[model samples]
Target: MNGADVIDIARDAVYTLLIVSGPTMAIGLGVGLLIALFQALTQIQEMTLTFVPKIIAIFLALVLFMPMMGAQMGDLMARLMDRVATGG
Candidate 1:
């Protein structure tokens, strides 16, 4: 593969990565923010408080989005394999 092909493959990989990770990351961010707000309001400075909810929310999000994530990853893999097959 030449420079352009390499760039295209890299771009596609990054795009797919972002698409796969965006939802779970957003959920985690939302949960963390909410927890932060709660801590701020209550003055309950418990370090572990944020970890549990964020982890749970992210885990649930992964479960809920697993199919879509798989589809995206499969598509990316197919594209990469196609490129390899074509000697690119």
Candidate 2:
């Protein structure tokens, strides 16, 4: 493939990655912010307090978003495969 083709493929890959991971990342961010707020209010500066809740929230997000993620990934894979098949 040419440089342009390589760049396009890379862009698509990154976009796909972001789309697939966005939900979990957003959930983690929201959870972290809430935990930080709680700590600020309670004056409890426990580092591990952030980890468990963030992990649980992210895990739940992942589970909830799994079907959407799978569809996005499958679409990307199909596109990539089609490009490869056509020697794009």
Candidate 3:
């Protein structure tokens, strides 16, 4: 592929990655922020406190969003394969 085609594929790959991972990342961020706020208010400096809740939330988010993530990844792969098949 030419430079522009390569760039387009790269952009698509990145976009798909972001779309697939967005929900889990957002859940982790939100849980972490809430934990931080709780720690701040209570003055409990426990490093491991953030880990469990964030992990659980992220895991739940991944499970909940698995189908959408799979669809996004499938679409990306389809586009890529189509490009290859067309000799792009």
What TM-score against the true fold does each predicted structure earn?
0.95, 0.95, 0.97
> Which TM-score value belongs to model 2?
0.95
Task: For residues 12-84, write the lDDT of model 1, one tens digit per residue.
Answer: 9999999999999999999999999999999999999999899889999999999999999999999999989
Query: Candidate 3 residues 1-88, lDDT tens each?
Result: 7999999999999999999988899889999999999999999999999999998898899889999999999999999999999998
- Model 3 ranges with Cα > 4 A deviation: none
Q: Is candidate 1 or candidate 3 better by TM-score?
A: 3
Candidate 2 local Cα displacement, residue 45, angstroms: 1.0
Each candidate structure's count of clashing pairs: 0, 0, 0
> Model 2, 1-88: lDDT tens per residue?
9999999989999999999998889889999999999999999999899999988888889889999999999998999999989988
The better candidate by TM-score, 1 or 2, is: 1
Which has the greatest TM-score? 3
Candidate 3 steric clashes? 0
Question: How far is 27's C-alpha from truth in model 2 (Å)?
Answer: 0.8
Q: If ranked by TM-score, best first, what sequence of candidates would result? A: 3, 1, 2
Error of 3 at 88 (Å): 1.7
Ranking by lDDT: 1, 3, 2
